[model samples]
Target: MTPETNAWDGAGKRLYLQEVGTRDGFQMESVFIPTEDKIALIDQLSDAGLAKIEATAFVSPQAIPALRDAEIVLREIRRQPGVVYTCLVPNKRGAERAIEARADELNLVISTSETHNIANLRMTREQSFAALSEVITMARQAKVPVNVSLSCAFGCPMEGDVPADVVLGWAARFLEQGATGITLCDTTGMAYPSQVRALVADFRQRFPQAGLTLHFHNTRGMGLANVLASIAAGADRFDASLGGLGGCPYAPGASGNVCTEEIVHALQLMGYDTGCDLPLLLLAAARLPGLVGHDVPSQLLKAGQRLDLHAPPADFASWRDRALARDQPQTAVS
Candidate 1:
């Protein structure tokens, strides 16, 4: 293919980003971020031009104590008119709670890998699907959309090399069961660029009208590269977290999700319209370190943007003049 026709060319394209920090990220934090603080941060993110925000998970508080106040947080936060506020719902009860709390959407997760399904959800894939199907029906009755997130879509920690067909098979099932979208999750950061391109192309071809979102982790440092690949393969939506906070509890080597600010910076530089406010995102990311009480994996938060130039040393001009003079050839005494 010519350069113009290259699949990887995403210049001038529009991309949508969904912020998953408050729900996915905070669940992994050892110290629970205060409920008021969570609301404030999410309100900040709401104004940062994100298309969607996963506010919190409505699962059992015992399962994820950090997000125990999901109901309160969901109710208290100020919702931006254009942004969709979603909540993770693990079952019928969670879905009911999320709907009651006025979540705009419900995100349900089921792993494509059987071992991971058991490890994460403590149920077989079929059981999880059946259970989530009921949640989907309940959501439909409530007039809320459901987005199913397929974990280990790339590879599984316990059962490695989950086939692309198996991944898409699960996606197909969810889509057939009234899921409005499918988020292909690289649960352990196992996705590489080539793998992402192939699977995303297949998904697009088969499910052209379905909402496609890619979720990645930076554990192998391939998160941004994978995002580019997915974009090339026609995926325009992605899931990211501020400060790169989040990991799979069941995956041994799991790490944070792709940093939202870093992805926005890279995409904007490439001429893709991400619609996110870089400065606002950075400001929000900056608060994560203080809230989580530790440094985060967000490079943009640490190094600033690539074009954020620094002033030169005080003596640089004099030093350059002396160095240039020394390097100049001296004429022999003529």
Candidate 2:
């Protein structure tokens, strides 16, 4: 489909798409996507009009070997104008590496569950916060924007039922410590629609100016439902991966992120402008199965759109007449 020209107004109605294929999507894959291919994907996504792209993570290679080429990928990627390239940093060392890479933004993740936090980062909540503060300070010094993500904010696979107070308290502290933005991450795909609405509503009310983003996984098939709830609760930013190509290696049964093309298609259909090129996003999703050696879960990429059936049999003149008639105003007959 052609890009929308006068389709969206520039105002509070705008929705932002943050493409996470490079970080979240590729991190779970066994195959090693060359740094050149990673850079090429970022260039294509930038041209597709994505506002932000999580380019890579500066974590330990032992933790996630797929992203070991973070520095090379970040340095080689073509930085498009108006697109914010971000990197995930796990600790002070990771933050230092990201700073060396001259990353545009640094994203830090902290878990709400004590057990998950200890298992994931080998630290207590207090220790994680302390490390996050240091990383935020380092990013500030390097003039890079710092964003903190609260993982398992909805529910934890190990601990189960993460309380709202726990999430809100952590968010308050992160903001107090100078977080430029905050993302609520459903790390294990256990969040429900009602829970999403309540959390986002409370957070938006408390932190009016906070740059709020939601990250959802489709493990139980509630990813899109949660996204709708968050949007209704005043969230405008969301995280999605191409063809939903990711999962939490630490959290068993956790699936990949919400599909980027699926989310973009939903937003465009709802008249909430995302500025993403859906046709191009479909092309990107189509490439994922071959690239990763598995079929992705994106519906739009597989089934195509209902509107795509408009000109079956390739009759150009007849299709043109039908299209013109559909676009014209309907009149009452005598």
Candidate 3:
């Protein structure tokens, strides 16, 4: 293929993508992934050139048995330079563990909806904020960057629509607590492109100093659409899982996060630089079915990438004539 014909030849635009397959992707899985396999997969992703990777969550083994090996996974993976390895810390204890594990960043989550917060976090909205405050403080002291994810920022299953002010208010408090960054999560995939554009705009206006990361789900099949809208709204970062392997355990009916390769392929087609090796990401995505023991929702996995064109049939020149003859003879189904 000529240089002009190649889709990946240019760095059109820069977009930062954080791979969360190891943490969010594995948490919902019922099958227990062996630590060695998990380490192997993470090691493979490490060389994919992602700027950040959420290596694992520091939740209790009882809460998420699939990620019980967070410590080992964090310790064993080959830490590549210029790559930030982050972990989810649900509380002070998780923060301490993340600190010991040498996580480059600690991700703290607090739902924006009171209903979702009580159900999933087992705490009131205020209570979750208060608790995460301490964790953020500890991260600051430990010299670990704190990224707070506001779950259900778009809409909630229980609560129909989330007001814009409520999300920004919560983010303001988290920022006041010394959070280094913020991630707006469409936990149930209720976010549309218009909603995403508006939210990102308001968020930048309200909290201009804090870093923003947009987390989306493909529940309603708007994941990549929302990514484009967000990018247009000046959102530079995103969280996507390999093979669409994530869902909220607490949020009923919530499903997988956006597929990594799907959006990566879309961005690459549009000339955006996501800093990832698409072939390697797809290779890693190829192994998810075996690890989780089921098929995943990856468009690229089923339909090959745009450039993977198939050759015409052996008797290509006769196809049109054959079809025309058949149609002419069978006209009107007489």
Off by over 4 Å in 3: 1-11, 248-255, 314-334
Local accuracy of candidate 3 as per-residue lDDT tens digits, 185-260 = 9988999998888889888877778899999998887898898888767788999999888876545554589999
Regarding TM-score, does 1 or 3 come out ahead? 1
Clashing pairs in 2: 246-256
Model 2 misplacement above 4 A = 1-12, 249-254, 310-334
| Candidate closer to the true structure by TM-score (higher is better), 2 or 3 | 3
Q: Quote each prediction's TM-score.
A: 0.94, 0.87, 0.90
Error of 2 at 127 (Å): 1.0
What's the residue-level lDDT of 29 in candidate 3? 82
- Candidate 3 displacement at residue 5 in angstroms: 26
Ranked candidates, highest TM-score first:
1, 3, 2
Q: What is the Cα-based lDDT of residue 163 in candidate 3?
A: 98
Residue runs of model 1 more than 4 Å from their true location after superposition: 1-9, 248-254, 324-334
**What is the lDDT, from 0 to 100, of the residue 298 in candidate 2?**
85
lDDT of 1 by residue, 87-181 (tens): 99999999999999999999999999999999888999999999999999999999999999999999998899999899999999999999999
Q: Rate the local accuracy (lDDT) of all candidates.
A: 0.91, 0.86, 0.87
Against the true structure, candidate 3 reaches a TM-score of 0.90
Ranking by lDDT: 1, 3, 2
lDDT of the structure predicted as candidate 2 = 0.86
Which whole-number lDDT from 0 to 100 does residue 218 have in model 3? 89
Query: How many clashing pairs per prediction, in order?
Result: 0, 1, 0
